[model samples]
Target: MALSSLDEVRERIGKAARLAGRRPDAVTLIAVSKTQPAPRILGLVSAGQRVFGENRVQEAEEKWPAIRERHPDIGLHLVGRLQSNKAEEAVRLFDAIHSVDRESLVTALARAMAKSGRRPDCFLQVNVGDEPQKGGCAVPDLPRLLEQARAADLPVAGLMCLPPADTEPAPFFALLAKLARRHDVAGLSMGMSADYESAVMIGATHVRVGTALFGQRGTEDG
Candidate 1:
């Protein structure tokens, strides 16, 4: 079931990429495995799924070590809000940090990277929708945050965003792409299970999909 789902999602990504005159390989699909068990992740690994996203640092720390030991080639992304205190652990575990949205986090991550001598690609998440409860930095504050990240010598890969739910996502995706271009960044981490195709059409380099690939959450442990 997972294999077929993976194949279908890949095919959809390819089609979306082609429609946008972009290569399918240009868009990476991150299988979000927040509540997923290690065995199910291994199943996807066996099926050639290499990139995975986890929402929490502690959950990832608990689940990924052994899986990574067996498959060192797999890339892990931290796709949730990262606390300043967890900076060192997040740096040690994730290959990419997609929620670098604050100045303090930038400072902590920079220090952690310096101490660990391992710098993961970082994305500055923007609250494109201006929501009061989201994890991204506000749009007006992005420039300052970007500067801070650069000054700290952090590898700011690109921009990430989650549009307001139930509304059209294209406008938000376009905004993020524009922000990336304005900031001279390269990667755009937008889109998820329901609207990844729209995201790819607009200019998303990375799409995080879980339910589509692994089934609905809580139904399967993996």
Candidate 2:
């Protein structure tokens, strides 16, 4: 069942990419594995899924080290809020971070990278929806944050966003893409199971998908 679901999601990604006149390889599918067990993730790995996203550093630390030992080529992305104190652990565990939204986190990540000699690609999360509760740099503050990230010498790969729920997401996705263009950043990590196709049409380079590939949380064991 997991293999078939993965295959179906890959097919959807390919179709979405083609519709955008882009190569399927241009958009990476990051299978989010937060709250999932190692065996479940390995099941996806067995089915040829190479990239995964996790929400929490502690959960990833508990599961990924063993998984990486067996499949060293897999890419792990941190797709959730990151605390300054965990910057070092996050840098050590993730190949890319998709929720970098503030100057302090950037500074911490920079110091961690310097000490650990490991630099992970980073995306500035923008609160395109203007929600007070979301974990992203306010849209108005994006430019300043970007400048701070560059000054810290972090590898700023792109911008990421989570559009407001129960509303149209295209505008938000377009906004993020526009910001990335203005900043000359190439990657746009937007989209998920519900609206990835729309995101791809608007030029998303990386899509964080979980339920579409892994089923609802706690519903299946893989």
TM-score of each model, in listed order: 0.96, 0.96
In the range 109-200, model 1's lDDT, one tens digit per residue, is 99999999999999999999999988899999999999999999999999999999889989999999998998899999999998999999
Scored by CA lDDT, what does every candidate get?
0.93, 0.91
After superposition, the stretches of candidate 2 with alpha carbons farther than 4 Å from their true spots are: 1-3, 218-222
- For residues 1-222, could you state the per-residue lDDT of candidate 2 as single tens digits? 444988887888889889889999999999999888888888899989999998989999999999999899999999999999999999999999999999999999999999999999999999999999889999899999999999999999999999998799999999999988888999999999889889988999999999988788752111
RMSD (Cα, Å) of model 1:
2.4
Clashing pairs in 2: none
User: Candidate 1: lDDT of 134?
Assistant: 88
Decoy 2 TM-score against native: 0.96
Score residue 110 of candidate 1 by CA lDDT.
100
Residue pairs in steric clash, candidate 1? 37-222
